[model samples]
Target: MPENPVLDPKRIPRHVAIIMDGNGRWAKQRNLPRIMGHKVGTESVKDVVKTARELNLEVLTLYAFSTENWKRPAIEVKGLMTLLKTYLKAEVQNMVENDISLRCIGEIEKLQTDVQKIVTRVIRETAPKREMKPSLTLNLALSYGSRSEIVRAARIMAEKCVSGQFDPEDYSEQLFASHLYTGGLPDPDLLIRTGGEARLSNFLLWQLSYAELYITETMWPDFKGESFIDAIRDYQSRERRFGQTSEQLQAE
Candidate 1:
């Protein structure tokens, strides 16, 4: 870690989201199997977790897998699922020990029964961790889309309205947010997509309205601690005034 290796806590983003991309490309560039890229990417996860905790980031959501990813070859999917199972099984104890609570948001029921079992077990076991909050959305965009989430929320609200749950006047941004999968979690303040991508790819569509975007060329396997820190540092240097002009922001 760099000495005083931190951005100002006051200005730090309360929540950070990342789209980890380019694992397969990285593997290919090195003449290795694609699974090898994913394996190496796992190493980057440890570094990012530690850094996020140190930075006092309240929430960190990672786009681990997408609904669209299922379109890939069956063997690749199995490999990814296997890696997920092994990683979750191996990380449960570490997550609890680190006080990093494990949370998931997605149509996890679609996962194989065995994988679901391990996931449920890990969540329960790490439920007591408080060191840091992590909400990992695996198999996201699979049966999960921002539009779908928003529509679901609206439907819930409509049902409530019909049932006389409350006045429709109560349906503000805050109220609508309550119906979201990330309802209790703070909205991501910063969103980064590695591998030089700038698109959202359907991750956290509603939560990143005002987020600062960071795009990097580093592949997921190569995106280690230092790379993450560099992005944060870059973020710290930015001027986020929401919608205000510089003069108005300065006056505030």
Candidate 2:
């Protein structure tokens, strides 16, 4: 792992979100089955996670599968689920050994019963490790759609109001955010999309409100640890004023 020469230790992102894209395209380019691209992408996942842990990143969120992903071919969906199960089974030990907590932020219950069982088991098994402040949390956005998540959060808040457990007048950005799927976690400070995608693609709409966006043409399967470090370094070079003018930032 080569150190990123330009990364500032003082300005590490508290949360980093990634859109791992182009698996099928990567495979198509190589004249291989799409699943083969996914298999290699899993290797990228491993490398990225290790790199995040080494950098002491507080939270790392991966756009693993989206609610819209169900529209893909059935065989591809099944293969993805199988691959997820296998990855979970194999990585639980690595997560524990590294004091990383595995978390899911999507409609996980909608997964196949068998896949759900494996996900649940791994989550339970890794729930106890906490060696760092944020414990290098790795959140997989499975079957996740930010719009649906926001709607669900609103529904819950509405129900709370109806039940008199909440006061509508007490609402604030913070209060409403607490109802989100990523309620307790910090909003992503940096959002990286690979395989040349320049859009959010409906992932983390609310949480990425002010996130610095980095788009790379590298396919997910080929994105390595050094690539991740480069993203961080790029992020460190930008100014994040959060609505403040440059003059205001300088004055402060």
Candidate 3:
């Protein structure tokens, strides 16, 4: 078992997002194919999800694959899709038993029909689970791009306005957010990126505007429960002002 800090429930982030990176580089260092690194990285996923659920996290969004990822070699893309399908199929029973529901926030239609079927089945099977603390949701951002998500939301809002379903007087930030892919979920309070990367990499741009970022040098395959604990601790140490001055925050 991994030793971890006892987090304060009041300060714990309601939603956590991760950009899992460095698979290819980790594999290269070992003189193995990149696919092998991804395979090992899946283990890290399972560990992190289990830990998050144990910690009572409300939502965990993983940047599993991006629209840009499709530009990789055909064989590598195929391998990734196959691995994802296999993992999803195998994890459905575990999800049901643990009360962890699955959700996909991306161009899900872009995925192969068989893979989509597996995802839909798992989601349906886990939908009725209500035993988990805080109701865990594991969001996989496959074929996702933040810019496209925003544009899609904008298009929907525009159509509503044109059809007289929306009024200018009813426009608000809350309304805009409701049309996003992450519609009902709270914005991520913490965004973590592994493998030493510092950029968002076009992931969750609008949603993460005010999220606390925690970057680490550890690669995805090596990141586990302890690593997540460290990040959460770091987040707890910081003060979120949300554009207010320190004095203003102190006065509040």
Candidate 4:
């Protein structure tokens, strides 16, 4: 059972996405190096993953690094990559033990060779097998940009059409989504952004078309299981009518 009294277990979101923000701000507030905040943020990630497993969440997508993040100082980018590598290496065994499958969505080729190797290894090791059905799928969005993803999918569809493998008239929302990086995954049910940011930050623009948004002032380093539960609780309070009227939803 969930620890939160207000959270309805039956109403839990199947897929939840988060944009972890404020690492630099958090470090600056503490007069520490920005990398320090990122380092501590890894601990929060562990906590949230544990919580997600406890809640039986089907999928958790984390916005780890964006394509635009490459514009930051070289040192910071290096530090972030190192942190990512360390996190994956350290968490692989834990994820396997916990039956959490690891997945990545983005331009993975853009990552360093060593980081790519580790990512590939982790994904291979944590993949769900016939006898080992994963309890959760943890997706890390690295070097990801929604616009670029959209364009990539479009290019693939166009090429298929030109090759006579696909018809131009076959383009539909469902068919287009099949070409996306998140083709096999459901769209996020909720999107949680830390650091009080309300914008999407070029993350999952299409997948988050109808996801409930939860913005928090808490920094990524400070967001833990309790904070996550609070977001879930808030989500359960809302009535997601999609495009239907409240009366129509009630009638159904």
The model with the greatest TM-score is 4
TM-score of 1: 0.91
Q: After superposition, how far is residue 243 of candidate 4 from its true place, in Å?
A: 1.1
- Candidate 2 residue runs with Cα over 4 Å from true position: 3-6, 129-134
The segments of candidate 3 whose C-alpha lies over 4 angstroms from its true place after superposition are 1-5, 129-134
What lDDT tens digits, residue by residue, belong to model 4 across residues 63-156? Answer: 9999999999999999999999999999999999999999999999999999999999999999999856589999999999999999999999
The lDDT, on a scale of 0 to 1, for candidate 4 is 0.95
lDDT, candidate 1, residue 21?
Answer: 95
User: Over the full model, what C-alpha lDDT does candidate 3 score relative to the true structure?
Assistant: 0.91
> What is candidate 3's lDDT per residue for 168-220, written digit by digit as tens?
78888899999999998899999999999789999999999899999999999
Candidate 1's displacement at residue 61, Å, is 0.4
Q: After superposition, how far is residue 195 of candidate 2 from its true place, in Å?
A: 0.8
Error of 3 at 162 (Å): 0.9
A best-first ranking of the candidates according to their TM-score comes to 4, 2, 3, 1
TM-score, cand. 4 vs. native: 0.97
Model 1 C-alpha lDDT per residue in residues 1-252, reported as the tens digit of each score? 665466677877778888999999999999999999988888887788777777767778888877777788888888888888888888777776666777777667777889889878887887753544354322222235577678889999999999999888887999999998888877887888888877888788899999999999999889877787788888899999888899998898
lDDT of 3 at 18: 99
lDDT against the true structure, per candidate, is 0.79, 0.92, 0.91, 0.95
TM-score against native, each model: 0.91, 0.96, 0.95, 0.97
Provide the lowest-lDDT 10-residue window in model 4. 1-10
Candidate that beats the other on TM-score, 3 or 4, i.e. the better one = 4
Between candidates 1 and 2, the TM-score winner: 2
Candidate 2 lDDT tens digits, 1-252: 684475677899999999999899999999999999999999999999999999889999999999999999999999999899999999999998898888898999899999989988887888853543446889999999999999998898899999999788977789889998888889999999999978999999988999999999999999999999999999998999999999999999
TM-score of 2: 0.96
